[model samples]
Target: MKYDVAVIGAGPAGAMASKYAALNGAKTLLIEEHASIGSPVQCTGLISKAALTECEISEGSFVLAKMKGAFVYSPGGEELTIRGKDVKAYVIDRKLFDRELVGRSIDTGADLMLKTRFMGLHHGRISVLSSGERKDIHADIVIGADGIMGSVGRAAGLPRCKKFLSGIQFEAPYDACDAQFVEIFTGNKFAPGFFAWAVPFGRMARIGLAKNAGDRPALHYLEELIKHPVLASRYRGSRTEHVVGGIPLGAPERTVKDNVMLVGDAAGQVKPTSGGGVYMGAVCAKIAGEVAARAARKEMDIKEYEKKWRSAVGRELALGMIIHKSLGKLSDENLNEFISFLNRPGMSECITEYGDMDHPSVLLKEMLKGADKMRLVRLLGVAFKTLF
Candidate 1:
């Protein structure tokens, strides 16, 4: 089979890319290894309202749980509460959300092939394994939207991912959940490299943790976190439906190569700090789709795809990686101090704004002013030292 663009994987990234490519007049094909689009859900699905607004997604699309505030728990049990007058964040039903995204792509005229796995790439042709049959599909350009361990990336010779976080989340029916606030627990005992979260999704809450590069299982860390004195009592009788997965941290060495572009988890576009990629992935995929369409029309250099995407979102991701690394080094006491400092007056608002997945660095740089300037500068200096 032949196509102008062949996208591997049907995740949000691939769906977005294919949707745009097809919308731009390219003959686009989207392939997914799984029979279903969003089965085996693996994300906590917590995101800021800005992301939803930018994506043009309505709040009614998924199970919406409004978050008016957040609570940060220090390892030593110190707590810092950040409350907002406006809506801060929302917890979503990832399975339904992902399905809606893929469905939109299909509705936009992109062809989909499910239960098909990408085998390899040879010349400009891709070999796909479908129902015990090996078929060679040719395309002018290819998109790798496969997850962190993407075969398309390997085949394209993109650099291997350097950082990873093992995450485990569960949907539990809980009687006592602060629907207006999301709770974050920070400390090595609960989660290393990342903080654990309790995201209220209506009647159920999603609880999870991301583990650092050690041999420890994320479940073990989750077990410890749920058993924490503050959380144990509330979660004692919750009914749990578990979701476990791994996420890539850090920026990709190169998101584009000859005749191919990588998007979403395949290119490690996830926010290193929060491990959220839906917004970033969709934004990058939108750009990649336009670039691929132009490339197909011989209107632009294919390499321009990398240049555009990197300029648009790479710096924030780079900064996020540095922050993630610095956060990994903090002890319980350090987290307490950080949270305490953040809760002082306007600092929490700054931090929340910086946590915007799109322009993290802009808000981060803004937070570097005022009384906490020295501390913020010190953190950036450490980030620079570590990243360089």
Candidate 2:
């Protein structure tokens, strides 16, 4: 057992890359196969207070739902809200935000290892199994923020499958929630590639969905989006807590190779339109913990840690993988004419200042120039004929 860095996954991009590689002195470590770090609570913890002030994280450790805007239903139910100026988003409490990011990476000294379980990665070391023994851990650097079916990104071969979606959150005890707005239903009978949320959180509220397992099975599209019809007539006797998961969508051909490196959702950095990835996996795990502590003190050349985490979050996850392949070929009457052209008038404050998930394609090319450019070029020619 040796390490300069071996942050398999304690979420929040392996706890901010083992707390910035043990605050840059290295010798970090932060494994976890969940003996509880943010337990079985797969996402829906909406974010955006400029991504919790770029991971400095502390609005009194969240649970403060003050979103002043967002509502975009329409499967013929048409509706659109978008407002925002004061508070834009926040419904966290993801187990107290993953235990305050693994207690600030064990108070910045790193070294965790709950319930272990990494189990393989020969040459570069790392092969655990914990509790019942079978260890061996070495590293000059390794971080795969295990997630999205991540086994440290398939033991570092990268490509841990993509084009996923299948979500299904829950947390109810409602009575027509609107803790300041955050509903977003969308077409395809509720959820196709993505879209379906409630997210209140002050008095319980998280109802979710993400579908697209080639079209169904995200708990049967979250039980047909809570039996639609305006979300089953608002609450209709709430009481949930379920929460299933699986949400990737696109972008993860390679989040880095050789000496490893792959942050949040194991580098799918999720968001394509809005699947959210805890502020782009904690700002790409704080730029892969300052480029893995300068690739462990100038020993550099891990492809310059994937070109410095693709220059900090590869162009907003490659423009959210091209707006999640053009909103998965719209249709629901083209998402009710793109929600009536994003409810006109300054298009929802330029979609809340370009959904600033850290420069999401520069706010998606400025919300495609206030949209409606010939119906966004006929929805990018139906997203290039449905993703070719």
The lDDT, on a scale of 0 to 1, for candidate 1 is 0.81
User: Which ten-residue region of model 1 has the weakest summed lDDT?
Assistant: 379-388
lDDT for model 2: 0.75
What lDDT score goes with residue 226 in model 2? 86
- What residue runs in model 1 are displaced by over 4 Å at the alpha carbon? 213-215, 349-358, 375-388
Q: Give the clash count for model 2.
A: 0
Best by TM-score: 1
The per-model lDDT (C-alpha) reads 0.81, 0.75
Per-residue CA lDDT of model 1 for 93-202, tens digit only, reads 77787778778888888899999999999999999998778999999999999987889999999886777788898878654456788888888899975789888766
Going through the candidates in order, what is the number of backbone clashes in each?
0, 0
Per-residue CA lDDT of model 2 for 1-388, tens digit only, reads: 7887788878777887789878877888898887888887887777878777766777875465767776778888777877666777777777778788789888989889899888888887888998869899988778888888788778778776467777777788554546788888877766875678877756667788776634456677677788877667666555667778887756566777778878888777777778788777877787787678778676566566667767776777777777777776677887787678767777667877665544657755776676456666675677667777
Candidate 1 lDDT score at position 64: 70
